[model samples]
Target: MYVLIPAYEPDMRMIALIESLKETNPQPGIIIVDDGSGACYEELFQTASRMGCIVLTHETNRGKGCALKTGFSYLKGIGASGEVVCADSDGQHLPKDIMRVGSCVEPDSRSMVLGGRRFSGKVPLRSRFGNSATRFVYARSTGVKIHDTQTGLRGYSTDMLDFLLEVPGERFEYEMNVLLTAAKYGYAIKEITIDTVYLNNNESSHFRPIADSASVYLPFLKFSGSSLISGAVDFVLVLLLHSLSSSLILAVWGVRCISALLNYTLNRNVVFFKESGIRHRTAFPRYALLAVLIACLNYLLLFLLYKKAGIPLPLAKILTEIPLFLLSYWSQKSFIFTLLNPNG
Candidate 1:
């Protein structure tokens, strides 16, 4: 097994982590990518190289996502056998945890193994809230409940290297994008509980709260934009057509078909543009089927809440939409606009 560490301007603890890993029985092969850390950090990289690690360098910082891809490409070039695990250089991921994740990597199994960290005891507020918000968004969007969306401790079996290299993202957002599209490529996620250790309250992390957060949430934001615009069109057309034709069913169905087309166009062209192996022929039918099912459920929920439960129609419509919105997003992400890999 090989452990890939992406380091940029790292501290001495990373060296310590490597030394500790070397001490373990049947020590794992270590590969480190120096993500454009300048001369000041060269000493650390030298020490790692002298200690028998394969050190790859980038002249300028290319971001974590790119560094990971570098390691994956290199591994493939060398014909690396056994498991491949990635860990942060900030010392948050313990050696034991790294090995635990590596142990979970099944050969030829399409699984992304993650070292799940439980944030117990003292934790930074930003870290806590950021994780909570990301977890909520990921779960609501993908219908996959992952406790740690931002964890750097992840393992991939040999079969997933090509997929990892193909996933889009240059920096912090890349890891999130992997989870967002993993299922679409026929990969299952396996989580192993690991310790949560924050050094100096995560001060060493290079994550920019404003910029990186926007990048990480870009897909979710785009999806929301498409849905909002489509919903608005649907809303306006429903009222306008109903006033003209005096047929609620005709107005609703007409608006639904129109709005779904707009949503599908935006999603395929913009929201999920990075995904492959899906075209209009395969996706449109799946999207339309999901839309019909969602429309039926929307009416069913509206009927139950408004007529049976004595709630106002306006308020019931709003209430019914919340679940439907999540359903729609999950279906589009995991089913409609996803890749189907024949190998995996």
Candidate 2:
């Protein structure tokens, strides 16, 4: 196994961690990526190199995701055929915990093992709140219940390197993207409890909570935003067409044709577009078929609610959309844009 550390503006604590890893029973090769910490940190990198780590440097500062990909690419080029365990250089992850995560890596099993922290102690307020909010949103979006969505200590087998390199994100958001993609591709994620250490309330972390959180949550936000805008356009067009034609069928068809085109474009180009190999030729026909099905169902429900159930037309339209909204999201996600063969 190889130990990979992505360091930026690190301190002497990194040297101590390196020394501890050097003394392990079966010492693992250490690869540390200097994420453009600059010339001032050259001495620290030299010290780590003297301590027997293969230190790689970036000319300028790149994000943690880039640093990790650099390390993975180097490892792949060298044809390393074992597990690679990634740990932070801020002294939060213990050397022993890093080894523990590495020990859990099974050669044949493709599962990614994460060193999960319980957050039991006096955690920083931001750390606690961020983890809680991200966990809830992650579960709601992907139906995967991960305890720590932001854990930096993770173990990956050699086979996973290619896929990891393909996942999109540049900074803190990269880790979240990995988890989301893993869940989507049906990769089994196993979490092992590890020590939770926060020095100075995790002040060493360079994560900009607002900006990075927005990047991490952008996928879900984009999906919801697309839906909301499409819904608004549909509503306005429905009312306008109804007023002009005085026919529910004409209004529903007109609104759906306009809104469906808008929603499909946004979803295909922005929302579910990352690394999703689905071509427009394959996805558009399925999407058009789903649109027709949903349109018919929506109009039937609207007619029943408005004409037979004694409800106002506007209220009926609103009520009719709730179920179809969920159905549309599910069908588009599962049938229209899904990988034809996820395992392949």
List the candidate 1 regions with Cα displacement exceeding 4 Å: 342-344
Q: After best superposition, candidate 2 residue 266: deviation in angstroms?
A: 2.0
Maximum-TM-score candidate: 1
Q: Which ten contiguous residues of candidate 1 have the minimum total lDDT?
A: 335-344
Best candidate, lDDT-wise? 1
Q: Tell me how far the alpha carbon of residue 213 in candidate 2 is from the true structure, in angstroms, after superposition.
A: 1.7
lDDT of 1 by residue, 67-94 (tens): 9999999999988878999999889998
Q: Count the backbone clashes (under 3 Å) in each candidate.
A: 0, 0
**Candidate 2 local lDDT, residue 203:** 95
Off by over 4 Å in 2: 289-335, 338-344
Give TM-scores for every candidate, taking all chains together and pairing residue i with residue i: 0.92, 0.87
lDDT of 2: 0.87
